[model samples]
Target: MEIILVPAFADNYLYVLRDPASGKVAAVDPGDAAPLMAELERRGWGLDLILLTHHHNDHTGGVAALVERYAPLVVGAGHDSHRLPPLGRAVADGDRVAFGGTSAEVIATPGHTLGHIAYWFAQDEALFCADTLFALGCGRLFEGTPGQMWESLLRLRALPDATRVCCAHEYTLSNARFAVTVDPDNAALRARAEEIAARRARHEPTVPTLLGVEKATNPFLRADDPGVAAAVGLVGSSPDRVFAELRARKDRF
Candidate 1:
């Protein structure tokens, strides 16, 4: 399986997942259909599936067009039927959908939206986490409370450390800036920020970061770090409060 990241509108990403054996592709959260259509045409592969993580316009707006052009199967939230603009299958958490002769497990992670889900390809160790997890920061609390978001992140953290996280947006640089503010003494983050900046300077994509590396360098994953707790001034009793304080500081930082 090859994961192709198509940088779409603004910071959004539409990922094209390919299975070499079948010569078929599946895309996650296609904001618009033209670019993905062109790529599929270039690769001489037919789109076999459309996996929607949520009902946000940016994530599902292109569903109708793609369905018209390629007639791919659409999978999405069961609670999001009306707004999905012609969904083929209303899926819920734990639903497994097959694509290009393989399968992706649907992980119900509701924080960015009430019915948000992330697709995990355990075989490939890849996750198309639309807006639930970012490079350094998590998605905003548009539909759920901070605590709910916290719980969702914890679930994600439980995945294997080798998992290659394929988040939906390119907010790494800006997120790194705030991460530094949360833990000014973090040498690891500073080095990583520089590396990420250099990668951006060369017009490269800083994706597929391992979960273990994020645990070491990303403040959003290290709310219990001494430096992070000190920087945020959280003298709490539980991990949740420390996480809560870090999130609040990030919101205003």
Candidate 2:
């Protein structure tokens, strides 16, 4: 599979995945059709599938346009089907949807939004976790509780270390800034922060971050760790409580 990254709407990222064998193409969280169309035209590829993570406009705004053009099969969470654009197929957690000659496992992640779902294409090692998980920070509790988000993160954290976390935004630098405040003494985090700063200075994307790197440096993913618990002033508290405090502080950060 070949994956292409297209930037849109200031910080949002749109992904185009293609299967080398069959030349089938799929778009994930297109957000905007202009850039995605341009890229497809550039490559002379046709869209065959559209995978939506949530109902957020920034993620699904281009669905109508893209569908009108390509008539791609639209897939999204059945749990939030009403809010999303008309879905050709409404999937649930653990459901597998085929695309580009392969399939993606739908992961129900309901913190950023009650019906948010990520697509993990195991064969391609890509996890399209739109807003539920970021490089150093997780999504805000827009429509769900901290516990829900924490559980969502835990499920994501259990994936293989080499899995590429293809989250949909360019919020890594800002997230890194807040992460250091909570995991101050973490050498790996500090080093990664410095690296992120350098990458941003060069206007490079820091996304598609490795799950292994995130486990080592991302504080939100480390809410249960002793150092992270103490940093949030929630030592001895349950992981969910510690996670809640960390999230609250981050919201203010």
C-alpha lDDT of candidate 2 relative to the true structure: 0.93
lDDT of 1 by residue, 27-74 (tens): 899988888888988988888889998888888878888888889988
lDDT of 2 by residue, 122-153 (tens): 99888999999999989989999999999999
Question: Using Cα atoms with residue i matched to residue i, what is each candidate's TM-score against the true structure?
Answer: 0.94, 0.99
Error of 1 at 156 (Å): 0.8
Largest lDDT belongs to which candidate?
A: 2
- Model 1: CA > 4 A from native: none
Scored by TM-score, the top model is 2
- In model 1, what lDDT does residue 32 have? 82
